[model samples]
Target: MSSPRPVWTGLVTVVLAVAPALAACSPEAAPPARADAPVIVPGAPGQSGSGPARSPAEAGPVAADVRFAEAMIPHHRQALEMAGLAAARTGDPLVTAVADRVADGQRPEIAVMESWLRSLGRTPPPAHDHGTGDHGMSGYGMASEEDLTRLRTARGRAFDTLFLTLMIRHHEGAVGMAAQELRRGRDRAMRAMAQDVVSGQQIEIARMRGIQRRLASP
Candidate 1:
């Protein structure tokens, strides 16, 4: 045999050269997905939400899902309006921060809902007043003109108090709507979204109550 060192080096080079090709063809040798791999859940037309995913075979959206999106769009818009009022009116950093969260939270939800509507071949409805119809307080919690007027003119602690009160009521209405979606919606995506609304709004409601209690103290 020629030098053993040369033969060993040639064998090592061949193994290195073919290893990537072997791995590509060998399913068993393929790299496993990392547990920490990023999970992207598509939300709006081009966005994503968090948490587990729906089944690919999930049924198409039902009436409850449609109604949920339609009603929630306006409900969320009112919340965004209410939250916007805080920035210019409150001296409290915590109040402004909570207001920012409300607006930030609802805006993307609106986009996701609208995207669902468009995907279902429905035109997104114009932004307007929240309609209770038969659902009443269960479906939408729209602030009255008087309620909004009071908020609009309020300043200092009054604004903070009014905002917390109205928002708690608003979140309660959202929770109620989510409850209905859980009961009646068929689409997996909408149902999952509704569950999120219920869980998230409940947490916010508790936080607002705590803030309200703090405000109540002299």
Candidate 2:
């Protein structure tokens, strides 16, 4: 009988020899994504406001008011990014419309908040990254690179379903952030914005949940 050890060694050698060739024959892979995984969008840095700064005492009843606004500007911006993905990438008209509204509504607010921050003589919290800050105000629930990958890969109804679901969660976090501002904010302008966030996002949240349900039905 042939020695089992020799037979095993031969099989191992053949498998090793085939592996590199198999890898070469596979489909071409895309370049690795960044750790932060920002989507590639071409644009100049937005125009900055030269508005006057507000005193710390002028901000709100508690530190939470200022903190909420400071944290939320970036959170809202992230939500806008997800909305942009739906608008530019997805095929669903419903998704595109919702995304368009989100993008349009938030852009003006970004400017408003930037103006508010400038008035305070403080730079707007870096809108890009917020690695866990005070009072658990985590900007917003940012979708992971994996989430973006899945969104990019999905199409048609599947893409709409994923976008709506992720957006619902993202909006819910915004509601929380806005509520904190409403509760503690002293600035009338800032409080007004927070109230708008709560009202607008709540309506949109209902709309998103409806979309999710419709997509789920047979």
Candidate 3:
């Protein structure tokens, strides 16, 4: 058994014996590739630049809040129209002044409420045409067709009387709606707005009533 000779050489024997030991020690030593995860490269931190989007409902009121806003917007629009006519038609300096103030006050409120409705993903209801013709909500008083005709046809003091009477009725309707909100509403801003409506319109109603009495006498 002299050296079963060099059939299987020393080098061949050494490779066969060492290969298993090396594999056992290494055990798949390669690291996971970088593409497999987000790289947290070292640098200054920064924001994502994108912001969370607001939902339609998140932008404004919803549910009963939406219904309230819808109803109130048209109502406020009507009030503004009435106020404008009072300003244009009335001759009594005090009545005209009040009308101007009322109109100015209501116009902005109309815009705010309408914006709120849009934000809430709601449509404002169509206003009823009270047939004042082009006069808008100024025609919304308890006055009949004949009364409105008198209002349109009259001048000076006559205009003042009709305007005050109509405005009183309009303010009453607004007060009624505001009261409804006080009773049934939950939104903080809207309810606060309703309270403002009540306070402001009530004062106007009183002023109109006084104007009516003053205009009626003699």
> Model 3, range 141-183, lDDT digits (tens) per residue?
4345575566667677877876777767867866776776666
Candidate 2 local lDDT, residue 39: 17
Better of 1 and 2 by lDDT: 1
Query: lDDT of candidate 2?
Result: 0.61
Alpha carbon lDDT of residue 116, candidate 1? 60
- Candidate 3 steric clashes: 0
Instruction: Tell me the spans in candidate 3 whose CA falls farther than 4 Å from its real position.
Output: 1-62, 126-150
lDDT of candidates 1 onward, in order? 0.67, 0.61, 0.54
Clashing pairs in 1: none
Cα displacement (Å) at residue 96, model 3: 0.8
| Rank list by TM-score | 1, 2, 3
Superposition error at 203 for model 2 (Å): 0.4
Instruction: Show where candidate 1 strays beyond 4 Å.
Output: 1-57, 128-139
For candidate 2, write residues 61-152 as lDDT tens digits.
23454466567776767677677677556777778878877877676666666555454444676766422333364545556667767877
Per-residue accuracy of model 1 over 147-197 as CA lDDT, tens digit each = 999999999999999999888898899888889878767555567678878
RMSD (Cα, Å) for all candidates, in order, is: 19.0, 24.0, 31.7
